[model samples]
Target: MQNSTCHLQPSLATSVALPVIYSLLFPAGSFGNILAAWIFLKQAPTKRTQYIYLGNLVAANLCVCSTMPFLAVYFARGYQWTYVSTECKITNHLGTLNMHVSMYVTIIILCSTAINQYATLKKTSDTQYSQAINENFYRCVLKKFRQPKFAKQLSTIIWLTVLCITVIAIIYNAKEEIEKDSKCYSIGAEANETTAGIAAFVGTACFFLSFTTVLLSYYCLTKHLSKIQKTTCIGEKHLIYSTVKRNILVIQMILTVCFLPYHIFRPIFYVLLTDRYCLRLNYLVEIKNFLTCLAAAKSSLDPIIILMLDKTFKKSLYGLFTKSTPENHQCKADIFTEETSKM
Candidate 1:
């Protein structure tokens, strides 16, 4: 017996909606990430731990931006592409790979930053960075993560691990072959239906791991900040810690708005997209695809987060537009340096 493939009929609404969604997403994501990348590269290398992760996050965003056009075109053509062709494989692979990689990498980076922020802020008014927090072994362990060297190492490891897993997953979960009655761009190949079940479970687990970690990080950090703010008078140090605390919240917001829905839908999509419901719920394919598109929207959103977290980048951005004198810029730079050193 030959293998059966997914043959869900692509609907006009989905066909129209995808291209429209991705059309807007492609240019916006690409332009935003490119501008962010330009600003990042122009700045001098620093010992800041946060910049390293932010840079890596920008790279991941660019990867998502780079793949958007091909995806837009694929959807614009109403899923007419053949599964057997190299273009299809490449587009599908890069699109899905970038989406998953970008989300997980963003998740890991945010989690790390959250932990680092907590570690930095957990110190008493007069205590050294680790001395106050050392009572909690976890906070003590974050010492390395606060360093630039550790950030670089962690960024490299995250990218390599995510890429390797994504490659393996694409190879195993998708076998894009067309038979006489099979459809090319359905949810997945019908013969390998079990793969979706496994992938859904795995994906959801990873998602919750990220979600919980970031959630707890936000809660703990905010709680600590509230205590400090209540007792301390208004000052630059309070401002610094408060900024750090707000950034953690920003990362948490990004995680919730972008990645949460995709994870929530995956298990349901997998279960319902089986033989029992696949043909009946043809539109489910597009709904899943749209959510995937929404996950990728973070590529555009990340640059704003970068600006929120990194004052240096923000200054440089403003300086470009405002035409400040050299001495003025230098003074601002010095002030920034002083503030950064205090952290």
Candidate 2:
């Protein structure tokens, strides 16, 4: 499998369409990831370690987006490899690195977000970060009996940990056998399929657990919010809390739907078709690549959702676009809210 070579001749229509799609999506995802990272950094949480998780999520998304140009160029050239073997290795390494980090970060974020949401349900006006911090603080005291090394600087520590892990993974993966003829290359060997399968299986299991936790948390939060809304007057707190809850729920829904189609079908399709077609599965290959690209859209679409829906994010983004005149800067500025709201 390492030395095998095959040519791809996609339909002209597809050739044209795929490049256009890739070109547009590449920048969109890149910008979105940057915006997300900025939002997390600019409006960092004061208490909960969960902000660390959120920062990791944004950073992972950025890492994923960084591969867009390489992928776009490969796809645009009809999946031809024009780069050197080292470049190919690096590209594959970066892709795998981003993927692993992103998956783990997603799991962590979901778990932390669930705790945050549950806290909101328990304390109506105290905020989620406060609740998470209080719970983690006591948990630390009970378990380690001392403050964790990263407690105060959890966000920075998480970021550094992700960076270290990602770099190591890339180096290890890149050292694997490289097929010179392939223009667009990736790490790992089909001979090691079992190991790859196990890694993917573990990652998938973690994803499902995280997804389930997030869904359940949102369900409980929504139910509680509905009851509160009906019984209590809709005041400033009600408005903001409701908005935050809604925004996060919508993001969760989008992630669920976007990720489901590929997860449900990719493995089954590969198993049924790969034996017969072997590497001659041009259509299937294209479909797989397209799905991968589509998945990349999440990074792009997420920031848009934040800016459009989240009041605080919108305010920060508006600040970026606007020049600060003293009069205008202080113009009540309450177009929405003032903070980098997290998910």
Candidate 3:
């Protein structure tokens, strides 16, 4: 009998590793996000801006997770296009939409949080200002949509924007053969170098700008609170400031550590890797693949970060999964509520 052992291409080796990791990750991410959305939905019945932002994020995560099965299959088949033509078309569109939507949604989330932080500091120098500001913002934006005046016009505009962008990206990807079987196919080389440069610049600007805004907001809030004469908010302000800062920092840390390497520096390495694609740069390709995978893995870890940051999520988890029956449920809720308040 022939020997079973054989060396594998870097791409094949990466493919071999994908399904095993993604199979575990996809379900966990899906379930956690579903659970978080359910809890958040139950708490606030109003359609507020924060709710809209978070709802979109949850929906984005769901869309991405839904694509994982097809992606898993792709890796399982060693990147072969095995689906029917129609199925291929659907998968291609869905996958591209999910990837782009997920990235932009994350950027928007970071930007929204930073803006909220700045607004909170500016309005009343109080964290509770978020509730009113967010509610008012949503009411203002959505009230027009509900009116009989131009509802259909606005709806059509929204849909048209989404449709145009989706179609353009699909066409761009198709023309570029971006999904071709290659060691670097997953990073999504743009249809043109100028387009890629623009995307990289925009994405990098949003990433750093959001991060710096959050950091500066935290510093200003701390400084303002220190100089304030009011003693009523001494304890409450400290608690809220500390908790929100920690939460933002956690997200910033993940984005900085996970994405910075792959998205920012990969172009420099990409040029070098191209010089010796056949033999010498194989190791570089392996590192690139691993970093890209790490970037994807951050999406899975986001829900866990939320849970760590929000005591409400932990309470819901304990209620749903633990032995907190009717007898102890009230106690559990109280405990978690107190923890959240302290946070």
For this target, which candidate reaches the highest TM-score against the unseen true structure?
Answer: 1
lDDT of each structure? 0.70, 0.55, 0.54
lDDT winner: 1
Which whole-number lDDT from 0 to 100 does residue 14 have in model 1? Answer: 62
lDDT of 1 by residue, 1-343 (tens): 1124335676765667777877788788788788877876775345777667778878888887777776776666526766655666677677655666666676777778777776666543436454556676776676777778988988999889987888787876455344533334655432135655675686678778877887887788777767766887747676777787788788788778877887887777666654455456666667777787888888887777777777778877777688678896687668567655755
Q: How far in Å is the alpha carbon of 224 misplaced in model 1?
A: 1.6
- Least accurate stretch of 10 residues (summed lDDT) in model 1? 175-184
* Per-prediction TM-score to the true structure, in the order listed: 0.87, 0.70, 0.67
Off by over 4 Å in 1: 1-6, 124-136, 169-181, 189-192, 229-235, 322-325
Alpha-carbon RMSD, candidate 1: 3.1
Which 10-residue window in model 3 sums to the lowest lDDT?
A: 1-10
TM-score of candidate 2 versus the correct structure, residues matched by position: 0.70
